[model samples]
Target chain A: MMEELFIALWVIMSILAIAMAIHAVLSRDLIKATILMAGVSLIASFLFVLLRAPDVAMAEASIGSALTAIILVLAIRNTKRFEEGGGEK
Target chain B: MMERYDIHRSIPAILLALLVAATIFYAFVEVGFGEAKVDEEGSVSNRFISNSTQETGSSNFVTAVVVNYRGFDTLGEVTVLFLASAGMGAIVSALPAGDKRKRPIPPSLILTAGTRLVLPLIILFGSYVFVHGHLSPGGGFQGGVIIASGLLLYLVIFPEWKAPHKALALSESLAGLSFAGIGIIGLAVGGIFLDNVISGLGEAGMLVSAGLIPLIYIAIGIKVGAEMTGLVARMKGGDA
Candidate 1:
């Protein structure tokens, strides 16, 4: 029963991860996309922990999610936000 | 509002997602479910589990792996961190002075006050974590990050809080030098790099029993903390 529950949770997590990845890719706003990407990375880190890879989870949470989010946010500030007409020309 | 997408960017993004999903699915299907039965008497896992207490004198298998079996790899990892920090510092230093004037303005009062109150205690706790890492789950990397976060808090809250550049440089250099000094001493005395040298392994579970492990960790913690703090300060355009 517990194994079944674990499998169910894993499936749910994977679905959420895929959904977040798609959202990150499709989002029009850079900030929103960045946030979605961060969320995906964080969820992936949690999955690593669930998989019993604590060291990899720590790296993912710290370097992958946090540092990448910060760097992307800073890059966003330095670059143009979005095309004025909402289309990439 | 729906907008026309750039096929160039969108295609790559979609492909990347697909690649990630495919890789994860493959791993889960191919690897994650395997389990092996162990013999009651003398399996490889059992032997290691039974004798690990005597071999490394560490109850935590991960700690034993990190500090004993793969000690050289840990040293190399520390070197990589040091190099990364140095590179970041050098790059940030090379930015034109006039460009510094255009950096982001300081965060507001509420943020600053809260950070100011919390940063010192966080740094203190990080030191404690590093000091006790061998005995607990925490380690140099965790503690280093904690210390770095404290410095980052300061940088965010007080953009103008000039980090004494000389002091940061001194601390970084000293830490690196001390690490090398310890290794050199080991080589001189024991004819092996990073050997225990002056300290003995003592009894198994005591605070000081790990010989050179604690000292190496302490050096790594200091070096990592200083480098991270320096990097954060430089990246934020604070005086370093």
Candidate 2:
């Protein structure tokens, strides 16, 4: 029963992860893309927690999602938000 | 609103990502789950589980493995982090010198007040995490980043907030050096690097039981916190 539940969880998490990856790639604004990646990180962290790796889960939640997003957003502070070669809205 | 994306340019990247993901999926399916199979009965997992508490005096097997069995790898990881922080510092320092950008306006009163209320509690929680790493779910890297996140929030709210550069640097250096010093002590006493020597492996499951594990964790916590804070401050352009 628990194994079946875990399988369901895995499917849900993977679908969310894939959707986020697609959204990240399609997002126009750089900051929005970074946020999408952070969402992906959050999902990954959740998956880690489900796998019983609390240590990796915490690290991923804090460092991978939060700080990495902050750094990426900061790096593009002086740059244009939208992509240079026009492709998406 | 939907953005009409030109998928052609992103095709290679997408394909690469899919390839990686598929490879990972295949590997996992091939390797199978440890909990599901329990293949290595009398080998690594059993030894780590059964003897970790007795030998390393750490109830947390993860902590025991990280600080005791794989100690040198952790040191190398720390060194990599230090280099990353230093690189970040150097890059920020090279950004035109002097405060080129003016401080932005302060956040609203409610936001500031809320931040002030929560900041101390956040720090306390982070400290608890690393300090109790040997017995709990969190450890140095996790706790340190949490502390840094609190500081980051504080910085974002108060734009005029100046990071204590000298103090941060000094503490970062001290913590890193102490980690090495402890390793040296272990080498001297136990004949192996980062051995749980010098300090007695006290009663297991207790706060102060894991000998040098807690000390090492504390040092890692401080170093990681300081490094993370410095990086965030630099990225914020507070020190620029």
Candidate 3:
């Protein structure tokens, strides 16, 4: 039963990751894309936990999702916010 | 340049991507995702698994392998991180000071108050993670990033706030020096760099048992925390 729940979560998270990746690519708003990419990293960290690598999971959650997201957001803040041509606010 | 989206031009690209994805999928299935790929009795991983506790006195084998068996590689990683952050600071500083970003609306009172309350807790938790690295799953890198995240929260709320650059650089230099110094000490006393000079300090499961492992991790934690905080501060256009 426990294993069943684990597999269910694994499948769900994998699907969510794929969906988020697609959305992140399709989104023209750079900030939105960055956030969706962070969501993907968050799901990847969850998948790491499911794979029983807690250390990797922690690193992924903190560095991949949080720090990378913040860095990308700061870059966006310094530059344009949208693809092609958009003025900074 | 192709002025508009051309389906004909993209069809080949799409097919190539699908073909590459299929090949990767086939390889991944063959390897059996999430399964241990090295389980042979005489394999290096097995050797580490068998001897890690007795040799290093670290309850966490991953920690033992990373901090003891492959400590030099870890040092190289630390150096790489330091160089990357240094380069970032140099590049950002060389750029012209742009107009300051002005947020139209002030940060919410809840966020400000909540950050003030949670910052200390985040810092405490980060230190705890690094301190207990040998016994637990997290180590210096994760802990350092967590600490930086706390500072990031404050930075987000207060865009004009500046980190004390001199203090951060001093702490970072001290931490880096101590890490290398410990390795040198191990070489002097134990005939090898980063040797477990005091592996028999205490009981195996206790905090002090892993000897130089904890100390090394502490240095790494401090160095990483300072470097990451400095990186983020400089990246935010602060005078580093």
Candidate 4:
């Protein structure tokens, strides 16, 4: 029973990760892209937990999602929010 | 001259991405997966799983492996992490010092108060995590990052709040030194670097039973927490 749940969660998270990865890459607004990337990292962390590696999960959630998002947001703060010269003036 | 919606120009890039993804997927399969069992005798993982507690006296097998069996590797890893943070500080410090950020409007009073209230709990939890490394799901690295996340929260909420630079560096260096010192002590007493024989293995499943594992973890926790906090400050472009 638990195995089924794990498999389901893995499938759902994998799909969400792929979709979010595409969405982040396609995003014109850098801040929004950063948030989307965090969402992807968060999902990856959850997947790690489900794989029975709680240590990896905690590391990814804190370092990959939280710290990385902060860095990306700070970098975006120093630059234009939108992609330049992409019909965005 | 890349256009906003250049469909024709993007086709090759799309195909290249698909090809790269396919290559990665093929590599994953070629490497094999799920074939090794934790209890299968003669396997390296099996030995780690079965004998870790007895050898390291840490209930958490992963902590045993990280702090006891693989102490040198973790030390090198932490040193590399320190170098990265130091490099970050150097690069950012070279940039002209000024408040270049256009921060969002100051948070509302209720939100500010709530964050202040919750911060201590987060810090305490991080402490508990590292301190309980031998008997729980957390250890120094996870707990340290969690603590750094708390500091990150504080930085976002209150940009003016700053930890003293000298204090941070001092604690980090002290922790690193103590960690190496412990290993040297082990070498002197047990004829092996990072040996757990520096202290007696008191009892299994007890907080005090892990010999040198908990001490090493505590050192790692302090060093990691200090380093990560400094890294956050550097990335935030604070005066380092």
Candidate 5:
């Protein structure tokens, strides 16, 4: 039962991570993209925990999601909010 | 609101992505996930796993490997981090400072009060993490980042507030010096840089058990915390 649950959680998180990554790339709004990227990192951290590497998970959560997101958002704040190339918003 | 993608561009991209995913899926199936790839006997990782506690006196094998067996690598990593922050600081300072204008609206009272209330607890927790690094999941990097996050919160809450630039730099320098100093001492005593030369490795799982590891981690934690907070301050357009 525990093994099944672990696999289920892993599958769900993996899918979520992929979906978030796709959305993050596709999103025209830079801030929204940054947030989606952070979500992907958060999901990846959860996947790390499921894999039983708590150390990697903690680092991923803190550095990948928290600090990286903040830095990206700050970068976005300093630059343009919307992507200027072809796609219609 | 839906943004439409050009079919010509997206179709091939989608197909390529699917192909890559399929390849990855097939590879994972062939090479089983969560299974050890290396031989169980005489492997370096296997040796570390089996003998880390006995060798390094750190109950957490990860900590043992990171702060003991591969401590020089960690020192290099910390140096890289320091260089990164220093480079960022130089770049930001070199940039032309624009007209200094105050924030249009002041920070909310609730947020300011909340930040003040939570900041100490965050620092305490970060300290706890690094202090117990040899026995727990967390270590210097994570704890330092956590501490920086707390400082970041304070900076965000108070736009007009200035960080004590001199004090932060002092602490960071001192921490870095101590880390290198400890390694030099180890070299003199044990004939190896960053060796566990603290004579006695106390009972395993205890706070003081990991001899030189905890000390190195503490130095790393302080150095990292200062560096990251300084980075945040620079990014936030404050004096570092």
Candidate 6:
């Protein structure tokens, strides 16, 4: 049924989201962490669409993913390089 | 000379989290209690479907909800976008020009050609979305972002391409001011905010029946598109 498919997709997306969040929190490299965070946002947006809130999904895709990615890249460029095995300052 | 406690950041964050949790709990309890009352009169969903056409002229319930019932909220959302754009521009302008780097080389031929081919169609589609917001699922925000994406594509393809800053600035400012101006005009004529004064509520299901909703959406589309494009260009300059 369609409901089962929705559930499957939700589960997969939730796992990806958790993994990305953990990577973002654990990573020492600022740029890599930021990119992971962007992926988390993108997964969240997809979940929003699945939950029947397309408008919120659109906003999340535009602002949460695209704009946040650009801003984080800029931040990484401006900051000192992250230590190889330590968290970003 | 080190401070004993760094209270500024921790206290505010803890307070914000507590506030959010409390509000969520309150909303849950309120909804639980309200559901019975809601169901007493033949289900709230039916009432919504029945009354929507009468109230807003649009068959699409979501569009009606966004453009009419919550017009004030949409106004606030657009204002937030405007403020964000202005803030980004201000931050970029404050950076030292000497620290800015030279523009990067031209993008790939495919990207350049694709952008040139698609930009006009993107703009056209965005305009279509805005004009049909009252009748369909698309709205000002959707159209605005579409327009912004086209400009962003152009920026990516042509590294040296600078958005005409002065024109965009003027357009953004004027769109924002005119949106407020229309609201003020409504107050002057109808003695209330956002009251549609120019057009009478025509036959239900007509394009012109929503009074000023379509006009407001068009203004929002223009303002958001200009502001977002300006923000991207400003950030590009700052990065350079």
**DockQ of every predicted complex:** 0.33, 0.65, 0.50, 0.53, 0.55, 0.23
Cα lDDT tens digits, model 6, A10-60, are: 999999997787656555567877888888888998998887667667667
How does model 3 score on DockQ?
A: 0.50
Tens digits of lDDT, candidate 2, B1-240: 577777777788889988998999988987655364435678787788888888888999999999889989999999999999899788887876444454456689999999999999999989999999999988988999999999988987887889997899999999999999999998898898898883455688888798999999999999999999999898777454
Better of 1 and 5 by TM-score: 5
lDDT of 5: 0.84
Score residue B135 of candidate 1 by CA lDDT.
68
Residues A17-66, candidate 1: write the lDDT tens digits.
88887766776678888888888888898888887766557556665565
The per-residue C-alpha lDDT of model 2 at residue B225 equals: 93
Model 4 lDDT per residue over B135-210, tens place:
9888998888888889889888887777666788998999999989998988998989888883456887888888
| Candidate 1 regions with alpha-carbon error over 4 angstroms | A82-89, B1-8, B20-30, B33-50, B97-108, B197-202, B238-240
- Evaluated on chain B only, candidate 6 has a TM-score of 0.75
- Just chain B of model 3: what TM-score? 0.89
TM, chain A, every candidate:
0.90, 0.89, 0.89, 0.90, 0.92, 0.88
The local lDDT score (0 to 100) that residue B48 gets in candidate 4 is 89
Candidate 5 docks at the CAPRI level of medium
Number of the top-ranking candidate, with lDDT as the measure: 3
Q: Residue A38 error for model 2, in Å?
A: 1.0
- Compose the digit string of candidate 4's lDDT tens values, residues A1-89: 98798778889889999898776766666898899899999999998887778888888988889988998887777667876554443
Write the candidate numbers in order of decreasing lDDT: 3, 2, 5, 4, 6, 1
User: Candidates' lDDT values, in order?
Assistant: 0.71, 0.87, 0.88, 0.83, 0.84, 0.73
lDDT of 3 by residue, B38-71 (tens): 6776888788888899999999999998899999
**Which ranges in model 2 have alpha carbons more than 4 Å from their true place?**
A87-89, B37-41, B97-105, B198-200
Task: Give candidate 6's error at residue B109 in angstroms.
Answer: 1.5
- Itemize residue pairs with steric clashes in candidate 3: none
